[model samples]
Target: MNNSLDQESSRVNFYIRNWLLGILFIISVVGLVALIAPPNTNDSMGYHMPRVMHWIQNQSVRHFPTNYTAQLFLSPWSTFTILHFQILSGSDRFANLVQWFAMIGSIIGVSLIAKQLGANRYGQAFTSVFCATIPMGILQGSSTQNDYTVAFWLVCLVYYILLSLQDETGKHYVLPIGVSLALATFAKPTAYLYSFPFLLWLFIVKVKLLRWQIYQPALQLAMLVFAVNGFHWVRNFQVFRNPLGTSPDYIIYTNRAFSIPIVISNIIKNLALDISTPVPSVNRLLLNVISGIHELIGADINDPRTSSSNFQLNSLINQEDLAGNAIHLLLIFTAIAILGLSWKKKNFNYSLLNYILCIIAGFIVFCMLLAWTPFHTRLHLSLFVLSSAFVGAVLSKQWSLKVVNLVATILLISSLFWLFFNETRPLVANSNLLKTGRVENLFIKSRTYWYFVGRPYFRESMIGATKFIKSQQCTDIGISFNKLDIYEYPLWVLLNADTDKKYRIQHVAVKNVSEVKQNLEPFKRFNPCIIFDSSGIIFEKIPEQKGNYEQKWFLSPVSVLVKTKN
Candidate 1:
């Protein structure tokens, strides 16, 4: 009878462990699904992943074109964040898979952060659930957007930071912390500023500056991180002859305020429009209401209404996203309440809150500097992870720890609901979010070409474009797309997917369509057999009639030109 009881006891423990693992497994799946689903999140499809593809093809991690992916160059840290994507999976489909797993890494990292903060298993699990379920986190993670990865690295950084703080006399923690921050920066240029917090914490809580010796190791770690990440810079400088990978045209051209009033207003506006906490941007509210009215009066849900800029927008949900936001707000505020109540007494972990605040401040300020546009939650996803995890830790009060776990369970269930229903996607079979401007339209269509071929979100769509290049047997291919910003990543994917085959595909990079004449004069000199072209956006120096070329490749809004003379 004792033996039988032992077997039953062992079974119970095994069942419970598997059950918890099962729950986390489901949350991870939610993270992956969010990435592969709609909106392409960010103009990301046209950005970095394409660079990853290019690096793979070139057999070196460098900028293929400085002008082509200047923003990525500007945000130097992002290069290392997705470098693995170039190595393992150059296809849009594979990138999607990589993103999914990266998200899982993020979730795992989040769990570790909670654990290091002295939270128990229940606390760690709840925080991970919160990160996975919050509408904005889910929304951002669901796409191939960079913010999700940023959050992942940030969580890892914070966890290691906490671990470092707890370490009494070792400098080893410093290296890991610096490396994580360096990587976090690549995921978002804004992360370059996050270093302020870690340094502050190291000086204030850990090293205390009483000993000047730690500074040397710390400085060395920082330098190593920069040295490792500097290859992308070298590549960009070599190509663009400039160190920065990004452009400031959006802010420069907008004529929007960059002055004191504007900067302060931007910071206030960014915090005010917090999605996890229940506030919406003017665009989002107007969008939701308009989408609701359309749904009530016969418009399709998936292809909802576009921006009031006057096209239809894709409905990102079956409902207003307000309920999801409300629950998160309560959790956040309650967490804040707990933190405030326990600020002096909560001795669970190190008192590095001040330094974290410093980092958060730096990150927020940096984002504000770039704030000609409204702040979207996706851009702020990493902050949300930090804030939410702290709150989750607070709410996992000793007496109510079970309640915290229960609420997290419910959120996990909700995430599963969205995953299956994904009310955000079109009710019809295939759908996409359309961007503004003619060039953006062509970029969207070229992406749509990939979407129709089964790559789900914008990032995956890039991998789809790469697959397109791989299928083409010709090596000497030349392409002229209207806008570099929108197609930079796609170009990277196409060029990198197969570099060994020797397809001399030249992306005719010129400032304007007027420069297309100058850009193509060389191609004409070389006499390329086929030149791929895209046209929902116009990039023409001479009339189509004046160009002595035959159209050979058809991408619909895109085409290929066979040059008769070089």
Candidate 2:
């Protein structure tokens, strides 16, 4: 019996080692891609990187007048991370790696959370593998998006909260819990919805922790959150009249109606989003079923009041914004079903159950408040990441060693497709090496080549405009984009704004809600010798300026307005 027990322990150790090795390999590959790729996701191009550029240009994180109000008001913690790196490095070269580091941290953090739920070495390491392989996590792990960063902080928050609940000797976790809360809150608004239930669960579990001897930690937590978010909140209130910055953009994304039917419709659609697959027929079938359920409940499938965007079952692309974790979703459902059906046979684990309950509540809260957008899979990243811990704990208890290994293998195999072929920043199909036959293809210097690989027309327009401005020896350039989601960061990059301090780009014609602040210095005093207008709005002269700024060149969607003294 003693010999057999030793062998069993040795086997588990070997499996743990293997799992850890697989996780490291995945991380290394994704980290390489993250380091190689330029930040070019639609949202990154639209506002994420653009906001960082503005903050760098202005030397402050204050609200700025522009067509994209999101760049002004969205949480700044993620950009804060980017800004720190950019300022220290003197370029945006390290931007994508921010999310990459978050991915690594989240993987490790979830394993700790798993251990707190009574998982042994094998189970804890398994949690790391599970997180490392999430399709959405893998896709966003290599981009400049905040989802993974917020997910990392939330993972730390959940782990620290559990530690505080379980700790009997001292209050070491209090500081970390507070810090994680502050960081997560400052990272994204979705953190509020996701963190609420877990915090409530912690309070319910230990109400005495709020008393005199321990109340200091709670107060510290509150102070930390306030300290991290206070300045930004004040700025938002001063500009938008709401600390949360409730603009028409946010209002439209919020569900306009509140009813059980709308909630149910949202819940179903949101869950279905995670299970979306690459097969068009299967996606259509899923859509039909979702639509049928909505009809039965007397709700519109594509209700503008309920959906933030046109509802579509898209599964063709493996985009960071749209990739869903179908394999992990199936694994989670299987674990839940097994645990529910067999709980009577197994010992009751209240901690795991409470954790799962809180996650479920978080999901319901998310569906209740926010309108369904196709990119919601990205928003659901935290919930998916938290679910990884639950899946690890439950599966470790229910499945045998062989079955656990099989599941892990399946997850790792399925994730490789996304890891190599991410739609925006691919490692394989990009073929940058063969085309250039140089090391630059996989480095920061080759960013422009990789950034413009697919969007040739947009690339041509931006590059052409930048070259034209340089030829005319213009330093102060004006830019106008009609849409809020236009690509503006590439212009700054192409013009060498980071390296050359001579280039100064400003919003030429401001007409958005953010324009209320245009009376301020930069907006008021920005005069340009030339303008790049992607808005396609032709004008005889620059707005609010008197001159013969005739349209000299038209390049597809972009037009050049050169100022001429008459």
Candidate 3:
């Protein structure tokens, strides 16, 4: 019996050692990709890093005139961290690390949550491996996107809530809960939806233990929240007359109405995102079933009122912005079914069961309140992260070692494609790296590389445009872009705006909801000798003169550099 017990211990240690090595390899690859790739993501180029640049230029986080109102209005906790890193490093070299660190933190946080849920050492190892292999998490982990960051904070919040419940001493976790909640709230709007039910659960648990000591902790919680978000809230109120900064974009992503049919429609459409397969026929069949369900419920699947845009079920994608976690979702459903079948058992842990139910409630709240967009899969990161604890707890009990190892192996295998073949930042290309430059200068130095990979011409066009601007000896340049979705960061990098203090790049002739709000700032006298336009149409007016722009150089039809003439 003693020999058998020792052998069992040795086997568990060996399995855990192998699992840890696998997780290490997975994160190392993801981190290597992140270190090699620049911030070339759509949202990062369009608004995320652009806003950081604007704040750096203005030396404040105040609202500025811009075509993309999202830069001004989106909750900015993640970018706030990015801005500090950029300033510290004196470059955007560390931009993607913000999400990479979040990815790491999320893995550690989930493992802790699993332990709290009664998972053994092997179970905790499995939890870390599972989280590290989530396709969407792996893809976003290497980008400057905030889905992973927000998911990290939410995981911290859930873990602390679990700790507070299990702690006999009350109010010990109040500060962590407060800090995590504030950060998550300011990270993204989706954090609110994903965090609602768990927060409610915390509140209910805390209220049952109400006492005189709770008041101080409660006050500490409020003050901590305000300390984190108060300045941004004041700025929003000053600009938008609403502390929330509910821009038109926000309304489009929000559900316009609350009805049973709308809720059911949203739930189905949102779930279908994860259920999607790479096969076109499978996608069509799934889409048809969703449409049929919507029709039966007397709701339109593509209702503009509740849809961000035209809705289509996406196929398997390696892109961070739209990748589906089909394998993980399947595992979650399997774990749920397993839990349900054994829920009546005498030895089951009800605490872990209740926690899983709260996360499900959060998902239900999300579907009921938010519109169905193809990118909702990325927003579902928090839900997926929280479910790892459940999966860990279920697999830790009764399941044989072979079954658990098999699931972990499957996840790691499925994750390889995403690791190597990311849509924008592929690691196995002909050149093997996205940027074209020296080995040390791949991410550190600028080249005529693809800032937007899909638009290959953007590289040469932006380089040529910047050279033209330099030749004209213009320090004060004006940017007038027609669309909000255009890439603006390449312009900054190409011009060496970070190192050269003489360059003053400002948005001129801005006409948007933010135009009137930009008035709050004392206007600077900006008269550009040259204006850059992405639309190929120059501005008709400058500061004082009825300035007409003559096309000086054209690198591409879309990238036009024009000189202002009175």
lDDT of every model, 2 decimals: 0.51, 0.82, 0.79
Expressed as tens digits, the lDDT of each residue in 515-540 for candidate 2 is: 77778976678778888888876352
Return the TM-score for each candidate structure.
Answer: 0.70, 0.93, 0.92
Better of 1 and 2 by lDDT: 2
Query: lDDT tens string, model 3, 211-238?
Result: 5555776788789878988888887777
Give the lowest summed-lDDT range of ten residues in model 2: 437-446
Best by TM-score: 2
Q: Which stretches of candidate 1 lie over 4 Å from their true place?
A: 1-22, 25-44, 71-92, 139-143, 170-172, 238-242, 248-264, 276-326, 342-363, 372-375, 421-475, 484-502, 512-527, 535-546, 550-556
lDDT of 1 at 55: 54
Report per-prediction Cα RMSD to one decimal.
9.0, 3.3, 3.5
Best by lDDT: 2
Choose 2 or 3, whichever is better by lDDT. Answer: 2
State residue 419's C-alpha deviation in candidate 3, in Å. 1.1
Kindly list the per-residue Cα lDDT of model 1 for residues 3-93, writing each as its tens digit.
Answer: 9989756754553364366556665655545444433332544554555544555565433432244434556334444566445553454
As for candidate 3, its clashing pairs are: none
